[model samples]
Target: MAAYAGLAFLSFLWGSSFLLIKIASRAFDPFGFALARVGVAAAAMLMTSAVSGKVWPGSRPGLWVKLLALALIGQVIPFMLLAKAATLTTSAEMALMMGAQPIFVFVFGRFLGSSDRWTWLAALGLAIGFAGVGVAFWSPGAGGGAHAVLGRAFALAAGVFYGTGAIISGAATREIGAVRAVTASMTISTLVLGLIGLAFGRLPPPVTLLEIPLGPMLAMGALGVFNTALAYYVYFRLVHDEGPTFASLNNYIAPVIGVIAGAAALAEPVGPSAWVGLALVL
Candidate 1:
């Protein structure tokens, strides 16, 4: 129960993140924002690791493979992809896309998973959950947009990556503590993103000190450390105790809040299918 609660909380933090990011994107480009987000998160996690007396996870020579995968899929690549995808898509559509995470978890956890066996009911639950997402997004004017097919494809790809990240976390939990897993993931993610940014000619990141609003910066940083890093801490802890499936239930909650935030705060229009989809997903 503690684990489930933790995961749910993390989901809430992350779910509401889309609205925040959308607000922030006005001043910073998607790549720039994602770059900053991961870069800062990595640094924060390193500082946290040192203060908490935590060491990196895994001593085995082969463990780097999983760690690398986690950093790339969970943080670096998905961060960039999602940030870009969000800029092009509506929050309602993005929320619906995100609603697919739990099912992705089930797919990787049960059908493709090595450690756990899945129940048919679980499969049915996954289907119902995603079907709910479709219903929630189906509308007349804007039509719970699906990211222009290509953009939505990227979001789906991010979901797949996040799903695999959970599997990596599941594997890592056996060898490392929650703090260690999260810290290591963030640290490596930072480095990997830095390397990628450099390779793509973004070295030193152009360092244009934007005179952006303090509120947005604070919100972004808060989202980074609290939602991304700290949330992962909560998430990994849950995976260590309650199993990944239970821990992942938060995915549903997060996206719903994303849609609500976008609609209520941003005044973005939502179609009726979105509510139906939310009900089905819930």
Candidate 2:
């Protein structure tokens, strides 16, 4: 029961992340937004590790290299992509697009020499998932336009990066504990994104920050602390207790919440096609 409860909470945190992204993006550009999300998460995770006396991979160059790759693929790239998508698409649509992640995970796992054998049902699911993506893209929802189509593409691509990162994470998590792995990777992501933000002049000036609305600032704080940091902790705990298969159930449940939250809270349109596509994707 506790495990199930944790799963439910985890699903809510992840599912509503798209809406938070939409709200937070109003203040920060893609690079700045991604940096803030990962930076806050990194700080939280680092503090947790420190309190627990958990040490990171201190001298292992190879593990550091792998963590760097995970930071870029898992944290940096997908984060920026999703933030960019938030500008062009509705939160609900972005959530639905993420349904493709598991499909990509399965496909990438096969090529990565996973022992899992292929089956007809898996193939059917893949077909259905891709078809659903096509349907969703066929008619962009509220504020539909060429830019929205491009946003959907970015969201889909983010899923691909996420899937690839999940496959790669197995190695890192094995070497270091899940919490430590997340901390190291997110720390690396924070540094990398910080440098990029500085290079591109994406980071807002201090006075400009004062002019930003309170709602968006609060949205960013909630997004980073709850949706990103705490969510990762809950998700890893669920994976440890219930296994990956059960933990992955969030992929199904969260999108429903995303759609509902978008429509109810943000008044984002959810046409018949969006429902049909979401059904097929699930």
Candidate 3:
């Protein structure tokens, strides 16, 4: 019962992230938005770890390197990609794209030494999933422009990265604890994103921070705290307690919540074909 409840809660956190990303994108560029999300999440996670008396991998440079790589693959790249995608696509479409993550997780797990057995049924599901993506991509009034198409592509790419990261993190969480692993990875992600922002001048200027609307600011706060930090803690716990394959099940629930939230909150239109595609993907 607790596991199921955790799954539902995690889905809500991640599902709502699309809407928050859409809101935050209005105030900051994609990279800047990504940086802020990670920065805030990292701070929160680190503080939690400290309060809980968790010890970090200070002596293990190799582990630090691994965490850094995980940060880039799982956090930084996907966050930026999804942020960019949010700029070009509806939050509903972006949420649907997340349905592809489990497919990638299944494929990547096979090659990455996961113990899960591959079956013909799983293979067929993968084929159907890709077909659903195609249906969504070519559906009428889907994106409405080439830029939106590109955004869909970016969203799909983010799913791939997320799958790869999940597989890696699953193994990492076994060595350390889930909270510890998440804390370390988020911290590394924050530093890497901050450096990238500095190098590329993507960070929002100090003065412009005051100019951001209250709605977007609140959205970012929710994103960083609930979506990134708290959601990830729950996710890693699922990965540790169940498995990555089981953890990816949240994708199914999250898209439904996201689509409904998008339509209700933002008045985003959801066409019949989009529903068909979402059903097929699920």
Best candidate, TM-score = 3
Model 2 RMSD in angstroms: 2.3
Pairs of residues clashing in candidate 3: none
Model 2 segments more than 4 A misplaced: 1-7, 115-119, 236-249
| Per-model TM against the reference | 0.89, 0.91, 0.94
Q: Find the number of clashing residue pairs for candidate 1.
A: 8
Cand. 1 TM to true fold: 0.89
Please tell me which model should have the higher lDDT, number 2 or number 3.
3
Model 2, 55-158: lDDT tens digits are: 87777899898899989998899999999999999999888887777677777777764434557886687668667767877775777889888898999899
lDDT tens digits, residue span 65-158, model 3: 7687789999999999999999888998888888888888888998997756668987787768767766776666455778878888898899
Predict model 1's lDDT versus the native. Answer: 0.73
Per-residue alpha-carbon lDDT of candidate 1 for residues 1-282, written as tens digits (9 for 90 to 100): 655567668878878877877776666666667767776777778889899888766577667777777778777777777777666766556666777777777778765453655689988988898787655434442533454444555665777777777877887766777777777777787677667767898644334545778777776788688878888888888777777776677877887888888898888886666677778878
Best by lDDT, which number?
Answer: 3
Instruction: Rank candidates by lDDT, best first.
Output: 3, 2, 1
Predicted structure 3, TM vs. truth: 0.94
Q: Whose lDDT is higher: candidate 1's or candidate 2's?
A: 2
Q: Model 3: runs farther than 4 Å from truth?
A: none
| Backbone N/Cα/C clashes per model | 8, 0, 0
CA lDDT, every model vs. true structure: 0.73, 0.81, 0.85
